[model samples]
Target: MRDILVFLIVFGSIPYILRNPVVGALMWVWISVMSPHTQGWGFATTFPFAYIIAVCTLASLVFTRQPRNLPTAAPVLALLAFTVWMNVTFPFSLYPEYAFPQYTRVMKIMLMTFVVAMVIKSKEDVRRLVWVLVISLGFYGVKGGIFTLRSGGGQRVWGPGATFIGDNNALALALIMVIPLMYYLQQTSTNKWVRRGLTASILLSALAALGSYSRGGLLAIVAMCGFMWLKSRKKLMVGSVLAAVGPALLLFMPQEWASRMDTIDNYQADASAMGRINAWYMAWNLARDRIFGGGFEIYEPATFAAYAPVPNDVHAAHSIYFQVLGEHGFGGLALYLLVGITTWRTAAWIVKNAPKAPGMQWAVEMATMMQTSLMGFAVGGSFLSLTYFDVPYYLMCALVATRVLVQANLPPPAPTMTRPG
Candidate 1:
């Protein structure tokens, strides 16, 4: 029954995806983010639903009337550069079989991101995309939050297996990023009940992050809070809400959680932290030595012997910076960094310029929220090598799409002048 239902939901949308590629994009995002098929005993487990959706959606785009709003700009070009570089580095991969499969998956995500930038034309489309993302990802956050309250944050909150957010740390990072999107939706929503629900969702998602017992999540949350408070239109109200919920959450966690969190201060003494540091150094040293680096699955014991400080510890490149550097060399890392930093600056520019224009107020709100999400990723990702993840790039694509609409339809605000001191 579950399999049948999932099949209907996934396959039923194919026709609509052909009619409107944007809807198809939303469905793809929903499945990728939510992994609804992975929830339980369902035929979706074996069914190639995602591949089918991708094929149908792209085929649909070729036949349907496209909005042609796709920006032929720097972000897209950077993405293409990064994608090409990945393929270039793949032949040098230490484990070609492992690297090729992962390469295909990431390439698909990149292609879909470009598709989204093409199909989504207006602010409302962006809003709806955010809604779908929040609902898909927030479902787990809210559910995990309630479970934390009931379990006292003793048991860790994990994600659906075989997905990007399969581990506690990964799930926590994802939840942290989506919280800002949830807030964006809440701010734009006119329905009072929706506002209330989103408020609860934010608190719940935070709790879920805490429940994951992820040190990186905790750090990211702190950074996120500082920005959230500063970026908010109403600082006082946001502060008050944080003040109310923060203490309660801390008190809810068990002594085990507390002791685990205390390890953050003494990271050098912690085996896991030390292992990550060693991996970072290995990636850095190896990238400096090899022009194309070691490529995927480069963290073997022998590779460590060549470059790692310890020369014995075999560890994954747990930091995003190291992950890209090790996998694709300096050229790939440079391209990746340029894309992210440029997207962030673009978002900031949008936030500054979109407010005065009523038609593009949603862009202002979204760009502001995008900054918070980027903050979470930039901070949390330092401790984890999720360089190939989709969420951040998707946010960047949203910013690109929004910038096109806001820039064309609305004029820039007059620059303010200050008196000489």
Candidate 2:
């Protein structure tokens, strides 16, 4: 019964965990887990997954058999507290409705960061969690891919009413960031069948990413692959040739894909793309004009009115840097960059030291993936507010925390003492 309960908690909740309130509740209690800020259609606009995670986090604190790992959690907690304080005291005004939702969004991210740090302690724990995420998302990807191919492939379907849903893009990014782990597992797994299965899963994920039709997602995959190539130049050159030729020979792609490629260049002439440029300029102007900001929600409508003749309001700058600049000015943007840089440096250190420990091979792989994901977001953020998604941000924090824990568990360097005769 206990095993059954655990299985149900982990597996049964995957589909609805991000959007449903009931499953989300289960997730918080070690019964389940999900990304709170996934872009999808569901029962709620923002999804109740974060609240569920918070609940489960509290439950873990109260009832888990293992003692709380405060050392691993301290940095995460401090960061969360600071973010909340900054949000509340930043002296920016926003529409009450918008501000309230934004507050919850920030809180959700903080909760995930805290829970992942506390919950994932060992190498095995990290592997298990990664597999769970991959399996759940892989199932969806396969299904979506089949449907897309059969129906002559158009916009991807999420749940009901999920128009413009970017969950597919989100899932793609998550899978790509785990590529190093997939490679490591393939190399290290004792079970041949398991290795084969993981390889198939990786391929399916890559295809699904292509099917999502998100230029940003494609850019991320390219950047990640480029990083891998840079890490191994000889292999990269051989692999690049094979990759370039393989797709042409194997697949007959739709014309829509060609159109999508054309759209990338459309930024030069397209009105919508031009509007983003205008928005950036307007954001800079607003930052200079206001002491703190013109107010959080005010920029979108105002900028649209000022720049676009059509009066199309924008809720966000669609770029994290511009959003920060518009909402919190130079000071807030500085702090945000500081947090991101600190997290990246910490993850890099783990990767640098990974070759020393046998068990750290997986950590090194995960760290590389994390770094790639960070770079993707850093670049993608120039054009989109990718930070609004919780999964990547929380995963980055988890990696940092995991690295710290791994280092702590390492035996102390031989103590040196000098005795005077």
**Top candidate, metric lDDT:** 1
Collision pairs in model 1: 318-385
What's the distance in Å from true for residue 421, model 2? 10
Q: Relative to the unseen true structure, what is the C-alpha lDDT of residue 373 in candidate 1, on a scale of 0 to 100?
A: 94
Residue 307 in candidate 1, Cα distance off native in Å? 1.5
lDDT of 2 by residue, 1-421 (tens): 4334444444566555444322332354222223322323343345444344566456545555654454333335446644764575345664555666566656655665565655556666565555554554555555555655565555553421231124555544554555545655665689999899877666655666666666666677778767765654367673875497437422634678657756776777766566666677666776776656544555557556764334563545767788777666666566667667767776777788766655666677677666766776676556665445554555554576567656865666788999999
RMSD of each: 3.5, 5.8
Candidate 1 lDDT tens digits, 47-103 = 888788888888888888776555776777788888889888888888787777887
lDDT of each: 0.87, 0.57
| Clash statistics: count for each candidate | 1, 3
What TM-score would every model get versus the actual structure?
A: 0.95, 0.76
